[model samples]
Structure formats: C-alpha cells, structure tokens
Target: MSGADRIAAGGVTAHENNRPPKIEIHGIERIFLKKNETNGAQESFVALKDVNLKVESGEFVTVVGPSGCGKSTLLFLLSGLASPSRGEILINGDKVTGPALNCGIVLQGYALFPWRSVRKNIEFGLELKSVPKKERKEISDYYINLVDLTGFENHYPYQLSGGMQQRVAIARVLAYDPDVLLMDEPFAAVDAQTRETMQDELLNIWEKTQKTIVLVTHNIEEAIGLADRVAVMSRNPGTIRDVVPVNLPRPRRIGGVRNTPDFQILSHHIWELLQDKGSRGGSGAQSAAVPRVDIGEHIRDDAVI
Candidate 1:
C-alpha cells in the first residue's frame, strides 16, 4: 500500500476497534412554530427528523448540510439549549436533561462580554461556579496560553482582532474544563487567512486537551479538515445521510490538503452530495461554493496525505 493509503487504512482499523460512545443521539426530532405569511396562522415546522448518531469518546466530529437542514437545531438539542420534540440525546449514557456544566458552547458571534477584559472574560465561567480566585487565575492563564493569546489577557474584546476575540471566547470555555466542546460556525466570521490559522491552532489545542468536540459549520473543507468523521445531513426535516470518515493523515495543513488527490476526491464526493441535494430543491449553505471539477481536469502529481 502507498504510505497515504496505509495511514488511511490504519485510521479506519483504529476506529473500528470497539469503544463505548461518548454521545448517543437516537431518533431525535425538533419542531418549531413559525407564522404563516399567507394566513397569519402558526405552522409547525419540522426542522429535524429521526436523526441518530453516536460519537465515540474523544473523537472530533463535524456536522455539515445545506441551509435550513437543522444542523444548528441538532446542536441546540445536544447542548440542552432546546429540547427535542421527540426522541432522546444522551451523553456518556446519561440522558441530557438540561444545559449541564460538562458541555461548553462557543457560538458563531464570539459572544464575549464587551465590558470585561480578556482575563476577566476567561474567568467568567469560573466565577459563576465560584472557583477560588487563585485557581481561576491559574486556569485562565493556562487556556489563554493554549489559545495563544498570552499577552492580550488584559485587553478588552473591542481592542482585539476578530481572530483574537474568538480565541478569548474559546479560552473562556476551556477554562471551565468541559468534557465536550460544541462550536457553531466559530470561524465563519473571520477572514480566510485568519480562519486557516485558527483551524491549525484549534487542532493543536484539541490534541493538547483531548476534548470531544462536535462542531457545526457550513464550510465543506473546514469540516473535512478538522473532523475524524463528517456527518452529512439532508434538507428540512433533517436526517443524517452519511458519516464520512476522514482518511487523511494527522497533522494536516488545511492549505496543503486542499490540493491533494485524496482531499480533492473527498471534497468532490461531498460536493456531489450537496449538489444533488440542491438539484432536488434543497438549499445549500451560502458560505460554501466548492468549484465543479470536470472528469478531464488535471489531478496534481505531488499529492499529500
């Protein structure tokens, strides 16, 4: 086998080794009420239907689907920010009752306390749990360094750049030492270059902390690059269509991976799935616009795993 193929095959073998699931989602469905524009009547909107997934301990999973596909709704349900209309979600075999301290959420908007300094913001959760002041400072210092915002501890959110602000948000959550990290399009607002940097930084941090992460994003490349598996969801009344294992090697560089044959093949596969959904009247994410490659297109010679 080629080196890349060996690495890919080994990853699958390792994954297949039986382990208990850290998160179990069974027959989950979410419904919402929306006002009908035509008759001023409340309409029941089925955002998700019968969505089932199991994420193994310490694995990184990303969920991707078109717009209105209930991706965010699923995250909300998992976080206990909202309840499923039907079915159950369990963490470590325990039913999710409400927003517990074990789950940490980093939202798309950065959601930082503008009035607080970076150090103070990172200490917010610790303060809420009434952690000792000395312990809180120690935890804050560790995560701030982990996210690489060491010197900016005293700076306010307004003073930091977009990427820096997001780092503070991440540090705040990490300070609480949650078992699962739920990120909803956290890098969507940053510039492309900064976004890639953040991606690398995040993977580094994920390695260091070993937190089970479930991230929701509209970006196809981002999903494949970061996740051990990508959960592809279908349109409104969402359901998981596939769980695509990322066979690429670890220590992936996002820019380099984008040009690899393996990466292109995987990316094309996902693109086709989304395109097929779009042709069938399923609206895709506005954030992703992967180019269509013809069968005759040139494949790069020096492919990287």
Candidate 2:
C-alpha cells in the first residue's frame, strides 16, 4: 500500500481499537466541478469523501483541517445549505436536508445586513418566522444584552466596529434559539485582542444557553478554549482523523487553563498531530500558512482552520 494509504488504514485500526460513537456520519462525500471555460476539460474536484464523525448533543466540537480539504464544504452540508454528493448526516435522530430552523449558523464576517439597524438585524430571524413584533423585540433585546451590544442597537452595520458587529451577529442567532449553532470561524476577522474578547464572550453565552455548538475554526487555542471536543480533519476529501475530548473542568479561565497539565498535554498532542499533518502536507495546520480557509467564500472570510 502507499504510505498515505497504509497510514489511513492502520490509523483507524489503531485509534478505533476502542471508543463509543456519539454523532454518526456515514459515507459523506461532495465534489466541486470547476469548468475550464475555454479548454472545456471539466476539472472535477472532490471536496470531501467517505467521512464519519460523531458528536454528542451539547458537545462543543471544533473542526480543523487543511487547505482544499473541504472543511467549509462539510460544514455547509452539516448546516443544510448544501447537500453531500453521497452520504447521510444525522443530528440526534433526524437527517439534515433543507435549512432546518433547529440549526443556527454564524459566519466570521458577522454577516449583518447593512440596511438594518442592530436591533432590527437581531430581530430579522424572528420577524421572518412571523414571530409577534413585541416578542421579537423582547427576544432581540434579551440577546442583545446577552452579547453586550445593547448600546449599539440603534447603530447600523457600518457604524459598529468589527467586534461589535460580531456581537450583534451572535445575538441575532441566539435570539432564534436554535438547537445547534454552526459557526464558521466566527472570530477570525477581528483583531487579536478582540478575538480574545470574542472567545470569552462566546464561552459566557455557552454557559447560559448550553446550546450544542459545532464550530469550524483554524485557531487551535480558540478550539481548545471553547470546545468540549475537537475533531481534527485531514487534507483533500476532508475527514475526521482524530477526535480529542477536552476533559478540562469548565467555568474555565484562560491563561490559567493553558497552564494545567491536562490542558498542556492535550494541546501538545493536537499540536503534534498538526505538525505531522503539515509534514506530510496532510492539513490540520502549519507555521507558514494562517491555517484556515478564506472567509469570503466561506461566509466567514477567515476560516484558517
């Protein structure tokens, strides 16, 4: 067998010697065909393959993989925006097909509409679903306060800073009260300091809502901090290679958790995995590259995972 093939086959055998399933993904696959307009040689690219992933409800799972690995593609399928070329995805006991109201998605750019004020933007979903205007206002206000964007409610998208915009975006989703939040690197566009703040804010929200969040990110640190489990994906035909459970006790404080032996061990293990993947040009992450997908195409321009 080829080296990659041997590793692929053996790695599963080695890793799955024992472990129970949580969220089962069966033979998921997708292909993107880029047409050569002039030459007319249809170049079909496989974005994902026979992939399997298991995530427990209420589990905060973050996925990291390589360039051209189809990370965003997989996420889109999970979010019900796109369908897999072949395969089935089940969350709890049901299959995902059309955009289900049960799943809320947050993109990196804070995709707030420029035409709407912060409050209106936050209320958009509820309004679309025909929620009573009064209840929509109430829920939007509650989540607006939750995200600490109360003062900015009157402001339009252009008036708010990137971080503030993201806060509003999050609140908008939270207002809808979906069972799962599928975030596509929601914090990637902000400045480093703001990113840190955003991370803390997300944790705070998670504590309150306990929403099952499945986030796609390139930031290992962010993944470590926010996720209950991290699923590392591989190159091309992206698939979960390792599912690391973050057993660290929560009500977590930053910097401090990074010092814990367990945290350090897990981080190191994931770091090593990234390195190995990089060495073989496998994907999880790397030093030279930002280690994420571009946000523009992803609905979150900074998906560096």
Candidate 3:
C-alpha cells in the first residue's frame, strides 16, 4: 500500500480505538472590536463562530476560504497567540492556555531575521529552549539538510531567493521539533512553480517526520494538492462549510496529481462549494463527477478568496 493509504488507514484505526485527536478546536468563536471609521465607535466584529475540527496524529489538513473567513484567525487560536471568545482548543487532551512550545508557526512573510544567517535562524528556537550550542548545531544541521539548504548555511535571508528563504523558515520551524506545525500562507509569496516545488518538499517532510500540520491558503489547487483533507470555510461570521477529503493516492506529486481525473473533479467540486454563497453545514462526498472544464479558469474568474 502507498504511504498515503497507510496514513489514511491508520487515522481510521486510531479513531476506532477511541484515541484522542492530536488537536481539537471545539465551538471556537472569535470576536474583534473594531473602530467604525465614520462614527468613531467600537463595534464587535465576529471573525469566527461555531468552528470545530479534530486532527489525527500525522495528518496533513489544509484550510481554504474566501479572504476574511478567519482561516488565519483559526491558526492564531490553535497556536494560542489569541483566545476565542467562546470554545476551547486542546492539544493531546490538554487545553491550550498560552503560547505552546510544541506548536511552531510559519507566516507568509518568512519572518526570518535579516541579520541572521540560515544556521542561526534555524537555531533560534533551540536557543530559547537553552539547548546546548553543540546540540543546537547538530539539530540545525539536520534540518538544514532536510530542507535542502545545506550549502547555504552561512547565507543570510537577503542572499537567498523567496523560495529558499521560505525553506529556511520551514527548517527553522522544524528544528524546534514541534509536534504540530501551523503554516499561514507560507508559500503565497513565491512564484507558482516554486510553490509547487515547496508543496512536494513539504509532503516529503511530512512523510518522514510524521508531524501533524494545518496550513491555511487562499489557493484551491494548493489546498487540495497538499492536504489529506480540505476544510472549506465561509465568511460573514465565519464558519466551516465543509470538510472535503482528497483521496488521491499518497506520495503525490503536485504536477502529476493535477492531471488526474480525480484531482480535476475534486478541484471543481471545491470550486462549486466556494461559489455557492448560501452553502452551509454540508459534507463533501468521497468522490463526485464534474465536467472536464479547466478548473483554473473558474478559479481565476472567481478567485478562491
């Protein structure tokens, strides 16, 4: 069986055995008080409501939605950078009370220190944990190689391309050995080809490390390409509209998978879901038949916010 099949089967077995999920978001609702420009009065804006999800250990889940649908807000809550007005987030059966060391986040901007070299950037987290210099070097070396940045260890962020810098950001996160990785549009800044390369690299990393990852993206192809399941969210008081499973065979290549009948069908299905303004509280089928039209044209037309 393919590695992806094993992961899918293992997840099912884990659930049947009543094992607690690796991460759980229960009844999450986040409210933000914003100043109204005209009135200069504070108004409560509901960014997220009734958000709930459970991620099994070693699963890769992607979230896609229109802009302002609280995708990033969900990651913030998961990372404990912010708290929900209602609901609780739990990791390994423990409620998250504050920033968690076991959770590492990567943002769109790369967030690498311009002054720090690749090695230094990857070791920053270990430094915080007071890992010994020798041990830190060992760990950083492993991750630098893992991300295929071994030769650029002494290079600073400015010296590398956007994609390379993003790799450094990922390596830095992985260096900390976080059980869960939360990525917020980590590859959105790179070119399309580079983004595809990064997606394949990430799948390889996930296969080797078995880390549970939840990534937020505005690209539907990206969302479906990298995920074991895609969580489609809705806005205007944001909520998850559907959780769509990607059953394409495991160890997938982004380019190859896009050409498959299943991939096109899945992309069209997700596109239709996003286009439906009134869609709420529905689950996607395991498989569906969709016309062989170019899904990209539709994506470009509506632009999967």
Leading candidate by TM-score: 3
**Per-model RMSD to reference:** 5.9, 6.9, 5.8
Q: After superposition, how far is residue 148 of candidate 2 from its true place, in Å?
A: 0.3
lDDT of 1 by residue, 98-139 (tens): 999988899878999999999999999999999999999998
- Tell me the tens digit of each residue's lDDT in model 2 across 1-305: 13323323432432353433334578898888988889989898777877777766666788865555677787788888998889988876678887888888887688899999999999999988999988888898898888888788889999999999889889989888898888987887889889888888888888888888888877667777787777776654466667666766678755557676666656655654554432433343433364333322332233222
Candidate 1, superposed: residue stretches over 4 Å from native:
1-15, 277-305
Better of 1 and 2 by lDDT: 1
| lDDT, each prediction | 0.80, 0.73, 0.83
Q: Candidate 3 at 256: error in angstroms?
A: 2.0
Clashing residue pair totals per candidate (backbone < 3 A) = 0, 12, 1
In model 3, state the lDDT of residue 43: 99
> What's the residue-level lDDT of 134 in candidate 3?
100
Give the least accurate 10-residue stretch of model 3, judged by summed lDDT. 283-292
What TM-score do all the candidates reach, one by one? Answer: 0.86, 0.82, 0.88
TM-score of 3: 0.88
Candidate 1 at 133: error in angstroms? 0.3
